[model samples]
Target: MPLRYQAIGEALRHTIAARPDADALVVPHQGVRWSWRSLGERVDRVAVGLLALGLEPGDRVGMWGPNSAEWVLVQLACARAGFILVTINPAYRRDELVHALELTGVRALVLADRFKSSDYVAMLLDAVPRFGGADQGSDGPCSELRFAIGLGRTVGDIIPFERLLEEPDSAPFAHLETISREVGPDDAACIQFTSGTTGAPKGATLSHFGLLNNGALTGSVMRMRPEDRVCIPVPLFHCFGMVVGVLGCVAHGSTMVLPSESFDPAAVMASVERERCTVLYGVPTMFIAELALPDFGRFDISSLRTGAMGGAPCPEDVMRRVCVDMEMREVTIAFGMTETSPVSFQTRTDADLETRTATIGTAHPWVEARIADETGRPVSRGKIGELQIRGYGVMLGYWNDPQRTAETIINGWLRTGDLAAMDDQGRCRIVGRSKDMIIRGGENIYPVELENFLRTHPAIVDVAVFGVPDARLGEEVCAWIKTSGPLSAEHILAHCAGRLAHYKIPSHVRFVDGFPMTASGKMYKPGMRKAEERDPTPRIPVARGSERAIKERLSR
Candidate 1:
């Protein structure tokens, strides 16, 4: 297929021309709805307003807020104005916020008054003391930061979002069109911060072509059409929501639905039923919670025909229920990270159930995927190795950090740091993260395999397996399990007895209420590993000589 070679602003213009009266955006809780034409007009107004604030092309504008119509408007406005939009996670604290601002050299910031319990205004004041006495639209502590804009309410000297919408006496509407024409598809349009699970977050610079095309392709895989209404409950700051959720809808002329400012299972169900949303998006944890609701059956999710799930592996049981109970028959499993426009592999709508659940499908169109060993040589098919990607979806580089960018992207391919195996048919199965792999007595163990096996037990609801420090063996297998009812470590070991290999059986097991989660709802394995290191609790081990005994039993 030919690539879409236009900038995001141009794409939106074409969408407006094609479907002027169709619903383009809907926020039920906020009582906001805009059709395609009206949404385009709003975006143009914001673009002009931003330019009126003395902002110019290539400036970095930071947006820190939850999923809302204003967030979507800022995204489009930045693209139209030829500014690099920097997305900040609403969950970020003072240090993270400061780091993001410093790293991107953001010239302006737009934020909400608060999200959940976070007093964003207070945090900003704490981070930048100059804001205490600075006038509205004046430079603050950071010399490059020209102004600050608040969405819901004015905070100190920050300009209110409403002011940006007001037409100035000499509005730069003509200049907005000029900038749109000058902006190229390869121009840096956005800088999104990585989750920073390992250390400090790095800004991944993405071009207009990369994001718009990725979203269009992802939407195409789900068979999205103009009539489709997509309910997006994920945080807009993440690529999964902004790139795949918002841009996906825009690319296909589908209506974008914001269930709530933040993720709420009840809100998602209500939005789908009320809006008759045909498409949905979320991580596996979101779907699990929605499925586990006490009154899950009360929601009329019959309208949900297709959707996408990513950010973590989707358990087989959860996938099955999503298909049957939630009526998302065409729901697909997407796999990728923030640096690659967030999706490299996505199960096609026509794929078989086994292909959909057992693998992450094949590489996307115009994208290449390969499994390579440590030295970066391609491994033979069906063997486990690091999954690397090279394509248009790859980011320009980590913003302003060539050293780190060179480390991640070598010879044109981005090292995903994921351990995966590909079938002869090209389907890829992510076994485990390279960092999460366990080495016990020189034998490598993939936690996902064991975790999947452990989940087979009727009492187990969820499981996360990782490596724990061991003096004898470099690392030992440890499992954290969430169960539906009472379960003993002995019972877990017995269940694994003859089914799995001796070395693969978890060396330790701990029952827990739930696993720690990241903002995007994926299991926070790094945090859990740190907690395990601190506690170092004595765990139940396999029966003495049980390994050899189980090997002999399985051999029979």
Candidate 2:
């Protein structure tokens, strides 16, 4: 099928017209369920209310919250109103919050009062001193932020979210149809802040054209139908939820089931059982957690037929279990960054277990993908190189940062920075990130390859492999592992003794209950390495007995 070049609002209206009474959204925790027609009506009411706040087309609107019915409303409303929706990570604190607001020039913000340990209202007050000040619209740290809508409770000039739905704004509400007509497919629909290991985060601008089609294509790969109920446990702030999970359902006219406010394993399983959801979506770590639940089999998750796993490298062991044990035989593995509307390639539902677990499938429909050498030249199949993509799914650019945009998107191709190799069949296997590759004693070592090998051990639940500084070899392998129980570094080393190359074996091993994670749930390698740098003895001898033999092999 060719890509759909329609605007999100246009596509949404089409679906509502076709499936007027079909279940569109269900938030069991909030006791809310809406049909397509009802969702469309509420979405329009919110859009009109936003315009009533004196915001115009192209203005930025930020959403800072977890997965709530309100979050979904604001997400679709922004598209309907022609405002750029900037998704703020629920994990962001004062500094990160302010940075995203100021960087995107967000004119209005809709947020939950509090979730988990973070007090969003207090954080906003601290980040923007003028938030509730006398001159609310006056110049200050967050100069462009003029309005605030609180999802739960309001304080100090912040308006309660209910007011938006109840706002008796007849004029804007009446003109909603006309307003939506003015919005085009190429208009900026969202700005997602991409987490960078270095410098500050960049706001990746995405268009309705890209997001709408990416979702449709993703849904098609999973063979979604109008009756499919998709259980989404991922955070709505990320593309994984908003685009892949939400938009995918809308594009396919499928029902969406919000499992919980945030990711809770029990809530997800319960929602699956209660809603009888046929599809599921989550990151690999999330699947691992759900499968590890003590009473995991108590829930009838057999309703699950298919799903997509992305946002981190999926372990082969876990993938196999999801198929056989979890009954998700048609599950797929997705790959891409935020800049590519989050998915450039995805495994097909009909793919065999090995094809699904070993590769990220072929390029998305109407998208061009290639593996390129360091010089930006295309590399032959079966050779590792940087993966680049050119398609409708590519992001417009980084918001207000042309210099960095120029550096990232060259000659219309967005450089993914991830190293990968394509097979003759076009299936691509991810090698680690180009920057994550370890160079030890003139040899190149991919951390993901090592991590995958370590995960094969029954005792090892999860692992993160990265390089640490070494005076002689330039860098050395270090592994941090989360296991099912107490396991020694010696035992881990003995397992890798013959399976892995000598230099690839972790020179230092530390067992931990958890690995540092970014707001988006990716392993924060830089943070782990920073903490390692603080340790006085960065290099520890590998497994006492095998130390001499391994040292001799590495020295040679």
Candidate 3:
């Protein structure tokens, strides 16, 4: 069924009203708790304040902070006021922060003053020159409507968060008119940027309907209970965390454990144990880190019944360890990108270990996943081709890039840049990105972007960025540069000029005399990657247990 307009806010309101006094957000550090009613009221106040900030409808507001109760409030307020919430990963450096804020032309920024020792306020201030410049430019960056507000610290120059509220004492708040305004099902509510296959960061504009329906459907598939405490250590900036963690929990009327800042394995363990959290919601890196802790067995993590494993492939060992070691009931495998509101397939709990460990599972309800040839024709099951998905969760399109959006979303389906295959049981398993896309610690990067930055170096002739398998990060970025004259890693890195973000920068730089090419003179990127993969000098040193198991099965 097609959702009526305002379905997202309506869902939130209905859930809040259902149990007005029920706990909505829990903060262990602050020892604070807010009921759904109170949360809604706060959201209303924030919405009213946002409207007062001179923001136009559809303006992008950068929610740049660690996960907190206020984070959820900001998102709700943005949605209610018809603002596009641009999520900012708290881990980003000053350069990254500046680019994202300017690229999206963020009208208002919701920032945390400090997370741990990292001061986001200082970072934003340093980047203010670039960000401020964008606002004045006729065709550069900032929207006509743009400004910033602080969340954590009441520092000099930055607006304090406490003052963002209009009149907290007021009931039902104002901006009901804004809420009642005509909202289209296609109006963008959020802009999620992914490093595109073409090596440009393309902002995927997801509508209110896309996000709300995706969250609701995912929760339904997982059979989330209203009483469950969903422990979320992932940053809400990412689509996985926002839709699956915050919105999904809200859709199911579940309580959210909102930690004040970025991830700490101990903090997560403590939060889960303290809250008796029923679902462990985080990336595979987080899960692995938690299990690697010496005190892992002592952390009473039985509260983590089951949850998601994606962003990067969850190895069979990781899956088994989560089930056998962490005691999770079923660790569901997922596959998607920001373009699809971040979920295309989720492994069924009933599937066998191979299916659970290997495939990304069947297409999500209301979604169709198919492996198609270059011409967009479907290939037979078990044949590798580009994976395409058509669904409600798919974004409306990219922001401000109609041509790129047209290339990505043809008709109703999204052409995911991932190469994949459907099994006999119709489960989709991702083979690789169709192009040179690298996912390092769940941050997608296109090789061309990095190569373009690298090529600007006086010492560089040509550079190619590719993914190298890593034990911890799943994939680490490796750049093979053919130097014009001569260049050291230090020299090359120094010349980056803060143009590329740290993740986008190369972790391993290999200087080569020449790169192999086809007769047409195009670089054989796969051949280069293959040669490097076969080099065998720096092995990734994966645990041999899963290797042995996989070998045994193949032999059978």
Candidate 4:
């Protein structure tokens, strides 16, 4: 496939011109339905509104919300206006939010007032002391944050989201068009923070050229078409949603159907039925939840022909069920990280079930992949080693951290930190992560980050966090702690309640006298992993669904 060296805004404009009357975006729960032309007009208004707020071309604008039409609008508007869109995870709590804002020096933040149990406005106010008050700002972090554009509901000093849509007295479209032309293909467009081996998350700076082409290629692999309606249940904060789900649709002029603000199994099936969606995107656990619904057979998801699944490893049984029961025979598995525009390898729809389930397919066009030994020499095919990639998809670098960037992306190759093996055919199977990162239900949770947070408790002397095999989530977080004071599992859970995201909190906790150590005196993580694997206890109670009933019957 030929690459398109266009900025994200350029691609959006092309699609709108070609398919102005076509359905562009739909959010069923929010009662949003828009055509390509309408979406384009709203995006432009938002862009000019952002400029009206004194935000320059290179300023950072943080998007802190779930999957909503407004979220999508902000994303494209930032790209069009040349503002770096910093995607802040909706699951993030106060500290994480502050870290992201401080790290990116976000000038404006677009946030939803509340989602489910998360009161985003309250959290933002708590995190940034200078947010709503008449103070110049604090001496601490997030001093640069000047605007909090509220979505859903307006409160206190938050600038209402609807206010941005109100037409200005001046000719705003011409002003926006002038600013849009200045955004180059190589300009930094997004800052997506991904947790590393270190405790803190690093912002991976991606360019318009890299993200546009990668999303285009991903859509190509899925055989996406202009008429295809895609059901996207993934979080928009991650690349899986913004890069692949949104941009991929833009590449083909396909309709983006957001099932709900957040992932809801029933909502997903409902949207697929109502819209006759041709494509669906999600992680393994999401598919599991959808299939587990008691009334799964009621939804006419026959409209689904193909989709993309990634983030965590795909289970063979689940893949088989998806092909047969769900009738998604053409569903493909994708592999990549935030640093590589989030997709370097994706299985083709034409491939057999085993090929799709067992391996991440050949490298994307223009992407170079190799399994390298410790000496940085390419290993023979079928040998397990470090998977490395060099490609147009690779990020410019981790934002503002040159030393760590040098350590990660050496000589143009982005160290994936994933242990993988390749066959002679160039198909790759991910063995494991060299850096112990836990992916719980599509959310990446770094062990060091959790361990560091747990250690902050005065009662805890040492803590170790790792991923244990989970039947549903692919992997769930497990932690072992050595405490200086009397501490129960309840106490540890309480400590992590508000401090960390729900998924990052450990599902299983064990109190240990001491940790098993290697000869070199490092913690022996493999030993702990093996012991946990032998334990017969279910990690967590399965929710009330067909899946739970089946598991209970099998256990009996």
- Per-residue lDDT tens digits for candidate 4, residues 7-34, read 9999999999999999999999989999
lDDT for each candidate structure: 0.89, 0.89, 0.73, 0.85
Candidate 3 structure, TM-score to reference: 0.76
| Top-down lDDT ranking | 2, 1, 4, 3
Q: Is candidate 2 or candidate 4 better by TM-score?
A: 2
Clash count, one per candidate = 0, 0, 0, 0
**Candidate 3, pairs of clashing residues:** none
Cα-based lDDT at residue 412, candidate 2: 95
Q: Output the TM-score of candidate 4.
A: 0.80
lDDT, residue 194, candidate 1: 86
lDDT of 3 by residue, 1-556 (tens): 3333454666688899888888888977767688899988788778777777777677788887777877888888787777889987676678777677777778788888787666887787566634423343455334342566887665545666777676854433544444535555577889877742245467788988778877777766677889888887777778777888888877889988865466788998988888888877766557767877888888888777777776655545556788878777666776677899888798866566778766778988888878889898999988878899897888888788899889988877789888877888888777656666788888877664566556556566556678888798888778777765756765654565245565665667777877664321235577777877789465222112233443353345
Candidate 1 lowest-lDDT run of ten? 134-143
lDDT tens digits by residue: candidate 2, 384-442: 99999999989999999999999999999999989999999999999799899999888
Task: Give residue 447's lDDT in candidate 3 (0 to 100).
Answer: 68
Per-model TM-score on C-alpha atoms: 0.96, 0.96, 0.76, 0.80
